[model samples]
Target: MLIRILFFLAFLFLIDWYSFQAFKASFPGNFWVKLAFWSFSIIVYLFVAYTFLTFSNRGVSSPNFGRMASLLILSIIPKLIILTFLFGEDILRVSTGAFQSIAGSREGDFLPDRRKFLNQTALALAAIPFVGILHGVLIGKYRYRVIRHTLEFDDLPEEFDGFTITQISDIHSGSFDDRKKLEYGVDLINQQGSDVILFTGDLVNNRSEEMEPWIETFKKLHAPLGKYSILGNHDYGDYMSWPSQEAKAANLQHLFQIQEELGFKLLRNESVQIQKGNSSIDLIGVENWGKGFAQYGDLAKAAANLTKESFKILMSHDPSHFDEEVKSFAHHIHLTLSGHTHGMQFGIEIPGFIKWSPASLRYPKWAGLYEELGRYLHVNRGFGFLAFPGRVGIWPEITVLELRRK
Candidate 1:
């Protein structure tokens, strides 16, 4: 927990530094500009903070309010100090260079008049909050758009052609207190012309009862090949307060019962055949496989009763499963589907720079669809959030994959 909190702070610092640099680069050097930048930034921060803090304690006493106000002041003081240390220099250099280029009306660098530069820097600080809020909305509300794109596999076997798989991952139902939202997502899924649907795990977060309210809504999802599901890291009754091992076992059993209630065929180290006209392909699903998490996915176990000649599509939640476990499995899975990485909830994708979120740096195929070694893997950005409780650029996903014959 301490490590996670530290990481979050470090991430915020990086964002502030980058934004400061960009702001500095865009403005012209002037005293008024610099003063306005800094003063406006201070005011924006204080205003937002005051608004939140004021409303945060609605029925508090005057004494309580005094203490809370002191605490708020203390907190902002440290953040201001930290912000200067973290971003002060980077902002100056980037801003000066930017102002010179803008003044000259070309892409060249030169130092700005120090006094004027400082003034502009302060003004730019005002713009910072606006930019920060914008960045927050872009990353939080739209991050998934970059990673969530419609994929068409032109070489899919004819048997599975046009097989649109409406995938939802990392539902984390425990975090969702509203049934109406779940129903909306479900309704959207049902409306998509999907021939088959795959739910790549993390269905109920930690407990079976978390999904109880949405069982009827989820059951409404029906396709010709039906809805199939696999387990994700959170599905194994981990990260919870259980009375005993027996209680955990009972929870898992109840989870299976919920899957049955929701009309989803739970795939646990097993294979099923989906028939189409005269040909059929194997749909295999395995237990979650992730590094340092559950290492229970057995490729051989999933293929035990299936033929080696079968055209296979495997649903395994973690993308790491494909890169590590299934990439070289003997049966040669032609297509693998997964989700788990929500694209770090931030990033930019452009012509020369696909500055995807830092999360992708840790996991190479962290988002979107990719192919390697003659096998295809599509990683869904996910339909929900976990710790942050909101997406940035990576929004909730509704993937519709079109499979075409080779």
Candidate 2:
């Protein structure tokens, strides 16, 4: 771990050095101007190092420190972009020299100095991502988009036709910095007026205490039928080191209690029957089940009393569960809701045009809707940001799924 940290810092320094070179070439000025630029660069470097060390000493549990670290790291993105252009120019210069030498033509020098236009152009281009990332951190992270999808299912219960279900996931409460912004998101969820509200998982980052400040805000959310939730990988406190097993168990119990306080029925490998008139549908929820993460969910146990004829909606945190277990189960799960990916909190999505994110490389069903074997899975982009403390193209999401009988 220590070696990895050292390597990371060294890499960051190299990028910073190249970025400084670009700055020097692009803006050659008086001593004061040079001092100012160098000072700013040095401060950023020192701050990043200090923040990481402080967070590491604190066991890296505090979300504020994590956010600070993220912001620091993000500040370097523009510099890296600038360096890319600078390095590309250098490669072109070298190639030109090689070709000229092969032709027996003597040049003024083996390699030319950095081009001013190229450096300036790189600086200009770097501003795009720099401003974009700033905007993402300031405004995009709280931009709650309500994505609605009406899914038609032949096996759906007639009574549940047009049943509206609002789903949100990956609410990393520990990372929230603004209460008013969070309240607005909760209000938006309430505004949907769906029949049921379903939270896929990740109520908190790692501990139950993180949700204490936002409990009342979430409790305001309402649904006519009910509100249901299942644990995500983060809610289990698996990422942190607990002093004792009993303490860890207690933390989980408190999290469950917090869920109840917020009017969410915490479903741990269990199923509930929702009734309407003479008809009923099964809402089965399992614990955090992912391919590479924790696997505490029992699909069979959750569907114990239900049969193949049951019209079921399964709530599992990770979308991978659908591929790994749910779809191949004996009973047909009509719809599965998940939200562990958060669309990577960055991506491009143009309706009817394109939807792409780096997260797709890992989780094939990263966001939006997917269907296989006539079964559907809806992956919510997530309600809150994590790790990065901000979002880019993929804004926070509030998903409303309407079930229809075909």
Candidate 3:
């Protein structure tokens, strides 16, 4: 691990050195600009290394690390964009030098002179993402958008034709730095006036206590029917270190209690009935199940008594579960609610014209609604940010799903 980290840092240092050349090329005479540039660059790199080296043992739990991680991300991304232009120009310069050698011409230098205009252009282009990364860290993560999706199904219970379910997933409370912003998100969920609220999981990042400070804030969310929740991979305390097996078990049990305090019925491989008038539908929930992550969910167990005829809505934290099992399950789960992807915390999503996220490469059903084999899945983008501590075009989502009988 230490060797890998050192190699990674060395790569970053190379980029830092290369990008600084662009600064020099653009501002040849401004000594102050160069001084300030190196000063900020060195400080950021040192802080990143210091945080990793000093806090690796107690890192995830520290509030300071989250800020440091975000700062590192903001710095690295723009620098990478700058690296792209600089690297591309260098490639062209090499090709030109090779061509001059073949033609037997003596040049001032083996490679052509680096153009000031290109360097200036690179800096200008880099500023776009520099500002974007800065904004994403500051405002985009908190900029919540309510996505309304109406799903029509032939087998939907008539009583549930207009049943509205507001779903939020991946709270990652450990990453939250602002209470007011989260409270505002909670308020937005309540304002939707949905019949019931379903949180598909990831109530906290790595530990249950992370959700303690915001328990009261989230308790404010209300639904006419009730609020239902299921566990995500992070809720199991797998990402952080624990003293003993018993302590890890206790941490999970504490998370169950925390969910109860917030008026959520945490379902673990279980099913409950949501009754309306003379009709009812199965609301089944399973533990976190993914291809690479924990496979704690048992679909057969969760749908033990139910059959394919039942009008069912399932909650599984990871969308990978849908493609792997749920879509072809004998019980035929009609709709699956999930949020583990978080759209990779970055992407370009423009609805119809373009909807692309790095997460899609991993999760086929990364965000919004997807249908296959006559079964449906709605992958909530996420209610909160994760490791990156910010969102790009794929902003945090509050999914409002209205079930309709067709």
Clash count of each predicted structure: 25, 0, 0
Query: How large is the C-alpha RMSD of every model relative to the true structure?
Result: 9.5, 2.1, 1.9
lDDT of 2 at 367: 97
**Model 3, C-alpha of 39: deviation from truth (Å):** 1.5
lDDT tens string, model 2, 1-406?
Answer: 5566567668877877878777788778667757876676667666656666655422444664666655565668788888889889989989877777877777765666789999989889888877777778889899999989999888777888899999999999988998899899999999999999999999988889999998888999999999999999999999888889999999999998999999999899999999887899999999989999999999899999997898999999999999998889899899999999999887889999999998999999999999999899999999997778788899999999898999
Between candidates 2 and 3, which one is better according to TM-score? 3
RMSD of candidate 2 to the true fold? 2.1
Alpha-carbon runs more than 4 Å astray in model 1: 1-157, 177-179, 350-355
Candidate 1 has what TM-score?
Answer: 0.70
Model 3 lDDT-worst window of ten: 55-64
Predicted candidate 1 versus true structure: per-residue lDDT over 1-406, tens digit per residue = 4465456445544544444443454455556655754564455445434544454322221233333333333334333543453356556767878787777855544644334354345544554444543454334432333223444455456766666677778777765545666677777877776778899998866778878877777788888778899998888877766779999999999999998888889899998988888888889998989876777788788899987777788998889988887888887788898998877654554636665777778789887778888788988878766544445445678787767665
Q: List the candidate 3 regions with Cα displacement exceeding 4 Å.
A: 1-7, 56-62, 98-110
In candidate 3, the residue pairs with backbone N, CA or C atoms under 3 Å apart (3 or more residues apart, or in different chains) clash, namely none
RMSD of 1: 9.5
Pick the TM-score winner: 3
Residue-level lDDT for 70 in candidate 2: 59
Sorted on TM-score, highest at the top, how do the candidates line up? 3, 2, 1
Candidate 3 lands at a TM-score of: 0.95
